[model samples]
Target: MTIRVADELLMFLPAARRGPVSRVPSDGTSTLGHLVESLGVPLPEAGPMTLGGEPADPSTRPDPGAEVRVASVPRPQPVPLEPGQVAPRFVLDVHLGTLARRMRLLGLDTAYHNDMDDPALVVQANEERRVLLTQDRGLLRRRALWFGAYVRGSRPDDQLRDVLDRFAPVLRPWTRCTACNGELVPVDKQEIERDLEAGTRRSYDVYGRCADCGQVYWRGAHGGHLEKIVHEATRQVEAAGVAK
Candidate 1:
């Protein structure tokens, strides 16, 4: 029996499943879908599979000289934010440290650590029901992962845009601790006045305290900068919708 597999699909499959040329399969019979999945590529990774130009389910068996075509997965469609839909949360790999920070600044629930091992990151993502965001292909290959995305861009800004576009989660500004990803609670100006700098005390009145880390936040120079970035990102998202 001879079976044909696409080059991209070959990279994720086990060595035993591939052949020296375009067609290989000396013995045994298996469904094309099962064989592709056995190689570590998820069904979603290979959008639709066809056997001999006919739409075939992954469960369909392959015969000798079967021409199997596995198409690459399409980019995720942007889902409109619904009033009751919960915001998407993320657990980023160590390589995406900057992206995690940006997400936090935007009040997105993002978990990150510069020193966490791969296994620990995966565990945290699963335990917290947070989407796994990574540049590593191996981590995305994990079967236990339910919601994961491969960051296609290299720069932090580009990566952030990629995430926002891909998931289309609701945006809530100034609600999270940028350093620790904890919820921010409103605090009276008098309560945190002593902790503020002399200049900050004279200029800013509004403040929020991080429930977990106890860090104080106010609309200082840094806060203004962060707000500007958030505003710009929001505008871009809105403009994209209008253009469509």
Candidate 2:
């Protein structure tokens, strides 16, 4: 009923050390996944598992005094698809509001709201088949979540880069509203003439309108700033992902 987590995984433990942990039942039977979870390290934190040095999955049940080991994973594994389940999407926690906007800017369908509570966030992630993205380790441990990732970066650019490298979601820039997560559709400049500010009208011609929020978008001087961010983020993620 004892378990030894990998050194890399020790961060997930309160003690942060490899050791014998868990309370064994009188019958001496405890599943590896359950034992790992009992130690405050979620199953997702363990990469490869083994019983007596042989390869095993999370479901393997070990007898008392059986040696169980867990390794660290680069990222959480995708949840196995179930019948009637929708395609997986990304769900950002409240703290990642800026990263949410960045992901939306890249045309990824990201779901986020700064005011959402933990319970509601978990529900949305589970019910919608979304991959919960957060820096909170406890939130990522929620058993209800089918797929989740721990954000390792502090800044928006670093976080966005980590996400892009992890899930490798399709990147389609300028198709979503940065202010609101709405799809941007092409609009004739004349169609939104009245909506445009005087400066915008005089400086830009092409336009896009949010189908949901009715916000107008045009490539203005600020477009260069956005392009630089996107270009830098893409380069960082891609460069880091290349095998050395």
Candidate 3:
């Protein structure tokens, strides 16, 4: 059987196997999903697929010599949800600490631990109904994962953009604590004055405190840069919503 993966997905394949088309030696019973994964593309990152020019799913077993075409996941991809869930929540692998903080800065619910093992991460995701985001292809292939996505970039900024482009979660800037993924609540300046430095007291009046960890936040020198990121993410999400 022959499989033709979309250009966007070709990066996942071995250099020798990458091209417009590929030949698969199917035993005539393997499902399309298994075949595609064997080629190194995770199912979550794969978009629409067709077998023999007709629509097909991962479970569809292709006959020998059949042609299968796999596309990359579309922008603003819909996140699968369980009942009662209002929005997509995410849990990240250890290496994604910076991305996790950035997501929190945008007020997205993100859970991350630098020391958690793969099993623990999967458990947290399933128990909390969060989509697992990781750069490790092997982690995404774990059978126990409820939902998973392969993070595409090596740099934090590029990785953040890739995530926003793929799943346009609502951006609520400054509403979450970047340090703890806690909700931020407005607090009187005087209430946290003791925690603030002398310059902070004089420079700004607005303040927010993390409800979970007591971390204080204000429009510090880095606020402008953070604001830029939020603005760009907001625009990206709005555009994605409109595209839908």
On TM-score, the candidate that comes out on top is 3
What's model 2's TM-score? 0.82
Q: Write the per-residue lDDT of candidate 1 for residues 86-198, one digit (tens) a residue.
A: 67678999899888888887778899999998888888987877888888777776767766777768898899888776665557778899889999999998988887889
What digit string (tens of lDDT, one per residue) describes model 2 on residues 86-195?
A: 32467889999999988888887789998998889989988877788898878877778777888767998789877776665546789888877899999999888987
TM-score of 3: 0.96
Ranking according to TM-score, highest score first: 3, 2, 1
Q: Which candidate number would show the highest lDDT if scored against the true structure?
A: 3
Please state the error at residue 135 of candidate 2 in Å.
Answer: 1.9
Candidate 3 or 2, higher TM-score: 3
lDDT of candidates 1 onward, in order: 0.74, 0.76, 0.92
Over 4 Å off, model 3: 82-86
Between candidates 1 and 2, the one scoring higher on lDDT is 2
Q: Which stretches of candidate 1 lie over 4 Å from their true place?
A: 1-45, 53-64, 68-85, 239-244
Scored by lDDT, model 2 comes in at: 0.76
